[model samples]
Target: MGQGQQEQVATSLAGAVSEEISASLAPVDAELERRYPGDPGTRQPVHTVYVPGDAFAVDTIRSWGEKALTALDTHAPDAASFAAVLGLSDELAEPVHARVRAKLEHEPIEDLRVDFEDGYGPRPDVEEDETAARAARLIAEAYQNGTAAPYMGIRMKCMEAAVRDRGIRTLDVFLTGLMVAGGLPEGLVLTLPKVTYAEQVTAFARLLEAFEKTHGLDSGRLGFEIQIETSQSILATDGTATVARMIQAAEGRATGLHYGTFDYSACLGVSAAYQASDHPAADHAKAIMQVAAAGTGVRVSDGSTNVLPIGPTAKVHDAWRLHYGLTRRALARAYYQGWDMHPGHLPTRYAAVFAFYREGFEQAADRLARYANRAGGDVMDEPATAKALSGYLLRGLDCGALDIGEVARLTGLTRADLEGYAAPRRGDLTASTK
Candidate 1:
């Protein structure tokens, strides 16, 4: 329940570092390699990626879109002029085929959401189901004809009326008409936007469950991911584990979890002011989530950086990428994957992903040398070995070297064997032997 062993840990770490300093001959990296032995590593990656985003989210139509994507890759702020925000048509419907077709053909776009096509809103707005039906017809026409082609995904309206009274439930008939008119799904995420607790997750699960049964839908545990963007969800210690338990409650029907950085920061009174992706407060929130869901099966990811850097110089562009990388790496260290709210941010998405996995593995490899005593048998105490091994194993999972089920499959001794038998030294031909 206590995700952190900090008071216990900080003291032990201080002691260990002191001891290591006193014993100057040992290479912190090498000394541990030899003292503890681990078995051969057959570790495969558990995370598919550490960064992801929407291909054609609203930001793309703006003049700064391209630069924004680059900024996401790095962390640089845009120094150039950005296009003014345009609402309505950008948020609402279009003028049928020629318009949609030209938008796809000439412009750089990848996907579109069928927003409010099927009407299911207030007594006045209950026609959202009809809107969904209309959108379905439009989408099917495009797919059948081949002019406007994109993998469509729609964000559903919130289920609660108190929330609905304030805002609109955008997509009412997506799932209802999904199999009927729109064909099958590429992927479905019931993007529960402002959930603050596990019970909200359970509520969503119940709805999905009952819906599937009533509709005779075959997928038993319909997977849906949660968005932890509320102050309540991120701040409460119970909030984090509650997410894992929610997924379990659904009997393994969870896709992924996303950090709603801006909304969460807003909920905490941090800001709707800064870019959502790279804020320091957001970083702390992400860290807490990571520790909370240490062994859960769900894949968690950091949210997107909101400020679109609209500049020209390559230097400025790369700087944006740098920030994106730092934020991404930090999150990856916490063991989260995926991001949202933009598509032009691909290069950043791809780059951060590699950096996280690579750096995490490299750091662990360096630490393993210390933990296992350089693959030799010289300088490790049992207690130090245990702590070191625990950090290594946990970090490996954080770095995505293992998953929850895999963690349970092996004993600590097995881990010790896989890590290294003793402190491994340079040119040690017998190193990695259990």
Candidate 2:
């Protein structure tokens, strides 16, 4: 062939190859987008405190937090001192402690889950209804008194076949009581644990829709979170990851996916003594949850450390230390939210979260600020990095760890910009930069 003709043929072949590649990859891209659309823009609480249904009262929860704070103070008078005892450097300790104090003073409980499953198991129907009524009354009262937690909800029993009827009945009674009293609290959520099938999630969503219509409440007002307890929830009968299918089944009401540490480990035949949040089984579940919930905007939380902060008065700090280690591990894994079973878990919960935020504060803030200002000349801030930075600032602000002024100072963005960055936005940080 002539040289010019050879060049022309090569160019045409390259174009054809490119087209073929694009066509081949389109389905894979579509499937990925379908599974993980990204960030649902939900408010994720750092910890869920599951108080028993029969005994849940806003005041009581508040009292428990207060007591935990007092216990913390007794162990370590201030954040710096606490850090010293924990072997944390002052740089890390001071900021976390400051945030901890602020959190305790203002909003200690980010999410309060009045438990009906394991926490308050198998109460008589009348008694359960009464407890539901009492919870509704307390929630209404707290709202009026301005003492309610920022996020509050109930943890209904599992929707598995065995307890499906009882679970729905309790939910009905609870919602009915809540409606009669006043209305559902703002940010109210329902937690359906041990979800093993997608059908269960769809049925529960319908139930919520029906309750809204029956009680004249706003449609889609209620959202739910699911617990990845059993292996069945993660692995379908087809032996493929079912996380995406379960989320799809929620039909847009899935706020979060919580890893049930102990239950998950147990399902793997891990002994009770060996069961823990950091187990491989639990980590696998968390990975499945992260991948499935990613790009979908759903919050993912780790399970709690069962090692309660309880012992002789003199040795109580020992348990606190253990819980702190577990909390730190969960934070390191990027599971910002977890379950808190006891009142005493509060101190470690705040301490670990604050510490995690503090550890990355300087880098995240500086990079984000530079990126926002378009000053990171050689340092490119990718979309993923911006999302992470924005999320860090959002969690700090939402949990009272950082305020508007601090966020602006650190990120070079105003409160409005920070709020906008809490979720996905049309423009980049440069659009919101000062």
Candidate 3:
């Protein structure tokens, strides 16, 4: 063909074919949008600190911070000493240590749950009722006075037949108390523990819906974390992934799926000595949970270690190493959050989190900057990788692992720009690139 002559384009399909295909799959498109809405782009707390319901007080947050700081002061007095204990790199030692201490002094507990289940055990009806009400009052006041953790609420009993009524009552009293105390706080969180079946999740969602109706609150205003404790929660008798069904049963109100380390291990008959977040059994369960939650709004949290940092200096150091190592391992595996059972665990928790983000800060920022600028680099990153990169930096900033000024300097993107990159659905991100 001559250069000036246009080539004839040939197509067999009708012009309406694309429209017809889209119309045929409209419902599926809607379903995909509804079910896999992607990350909410909210600040996910680094760790959840669970205090027994009866033990929770208005000052619990401050108390935990003080205790953690005291633990740091007594165990590792200086940045170099603390870094030595955790074996942090020479470059990261000073910054990570300083940031960890600053985090403890400022925002020690990110998310807190007043445990009404295993930690509280079985209590008298009236006593339990009073405790639940008190928790609400204290939590309400904490939020009112700006002393509350970023997220706070109760972890009620399971939907099992055994304690179903009690669990319902506690949740009712707590939520009602919050309402009576002047409405729910923005950071309210709830956990439905020991869920073994999807039906239990459905029941919990229904219960929350009823609560919203009763309070005249907006529909779907209440969301809770589903605690996966039983082996049956991971795998049903029918050999399907029960946890996936549970997420669907939540009806878009499931914010997280938290692993219950000890309970899950016990359910699987793992010996106590071998039950841990990094155990093969634990990893398998979490891997399934991660896949189930991926692209969905739900997040997965790792279970806690029972090793408390206490006793002699040497013993505390050993425990710190264990907790720090577990936290770092979890971070690497994309489990951004876990449970901190003891105040003593706080120091090591921040240390591990800060180190993880700091160690990778420059690389992530560079890749994200390159992607944002469309500048070619050694590692070619697509939008999906850009999403991950921006997400990593945002998480680091949220948890105080990296400073805004530094991130801005390196990435040449403001917080808003990072959010723009990180907040979209994965499908949207890739589609836009295409």
Candidate 4:
């Protein structure tokens, strides 16, 4: 067609959509906005370290860091030795090892939970109350003194009939203590364990609502991780996915859905000897949790391994290899977080995390840089791919895996630029040309 004809055709096509169609679909657009809000674009801790409530103390964080360092000193005293144990590549060994050591010295534990559930077991009401209050005091002091982890809170007992009342009382004591101390810290986190039904999640949300009302805080001020530790939590008796319902039931108060490796595996009748996070049963449950949490601002975390890296050097090496392999495997599967049950697990955790990001750092940065500049490359990139690339680097930066200077140098984009690309509004992601 002639240029004049083409110009006329383009003008005619500009307003082809009817007002009736847009008006009819308005509610659907609102529903879509409400339902899938995408990621919150905040820092997600790579692991949550659990300590029994009664066992928690002011020195717990430092103690864990010290113990992890001690383990490194005893088992693998040098980078080469540690790399040999984990079979890290020559290119990654020195940098990954140095970063792991620095991370251990500075921020060994990212997220910590003072466990009142299985780890604490059942305690006398009076003793539990005192312990709960003590935990609050210590945690508050830690934050005040600038010695706290990035995230810290309690894992209260589940809402099961046998322990529901105790759990409520403990949470009340803890939060009330925090309020009395100096108001809640921004780093506070909570975990609700062994949830099986959506109604239980609703009940938990209601409990939080009541607390907020009592404290004069804004509604939805509290959010907790829902622990998926039962088979029923994955698949209801009626065959619908109960985890999805649980997320919705949280009423915008769900921060994460954390898999419970042992509890979940045992619920499926997996033998104790065979129970592990990488087990088929555990994978299935976590996969469902991941899908349910996608685009809901709720993160998914994998469960922990019971194996402790202690005793003889040979035994500890074996345990380190196991932990390192599992951590790498989880990262590969996009399960960026997990649970750490011991101080010894810290070394391997950082090592695996650092290696994962560093190995792919150049490729991710190059692709994102290309997309940012809109430069043509061998690969055809889209906005979604760019978002993923930016997210990967952002996560790496958040967890000490990548430095901001290096990221900026490679991508030629600042942190604010990365955040804009990583967390664009729903429709903005796809509205731009490749």
Compute the lDDT for candidate 4: 0.93
User: In candidate 1, which residue ranges exceed 4 Å CA deviation?
Assistant: 1-131, 134-152, 164-172, 219-221, 235-245, 248-251, 272-280, 314-319, 334-336, 354-434
Tens digits of per-residue lDDT for model 1 on 260-285?
A: 76677777677455645567777776
Q: In terms of TM-score, how similar is model 1 to the real structure?
A: 0.51
Please give the CA lDDT of all the candidate structures. Answer: 0.46, 0.79, 0.94, 0.93
On residues 1-434, what C-alpha lDDT tens digit does candidate 4 reach at each position?
66656453334433436677788899998877777888988899999999999899989999999999999999999999999999998999899889988998999999999999999999889999999999999999999999999999999999999999999999999999999999899999999999999999999999999999999999988999999999999999999999999999999999999999998998999999999998988888888988888888899999899999999999999999999999999999999999999999999999999999999999999999988898868887778888888999999999999999999999999999999989987787677564
For residues 1-434, what per-residue lDDT tens digits would candidate 3 score against the true structure?
Answer: 78999889899998799999999999999999899999999999999999999899878888999999999999999988999999998899899889988998899999999999999999999999999999999999999988889999999988989999999999999999999999999999999999988999999999999999988999999999999999999998989999999999999999999999999999999999998999999999999999999988999999999999999999999999999999999999999999999999999999999999999999999999988898877988877788889999999999999999999999899999999888865466656332
Cα RMSD for predicted model 4:
1.7
Every candidate's CA RMSD: 16.2, 5.4, 1.7, 1.7
Question: Candidate 2 on 1-434: residue-level lDDT in tens?
Answer: 76656453334365789889989999987875666666765567889888898778667656876877887778777877778655667677777777777777678788888888988988788888788777767876777688888777788888888778888888887777777777777767789998888998899999999988887777878889988899998999898888788888887788889988888898889999889887777888899899888767678898887877676644667777777888888877788898888777787788877777767776878887876677865567765577778888777777766667766777778766755555554345235333
Off by over 4 Å in 4: 1-6, 10-17, 432-434
Query: Local error of candidate 1 at 6, Å?
Result: 47
**Which regions of candidate 3 fall more than 4 Å away from where they truly are?**
1-12, 425-427, 431-434
Worst 10 residues of 2 by lDDT: 425-434
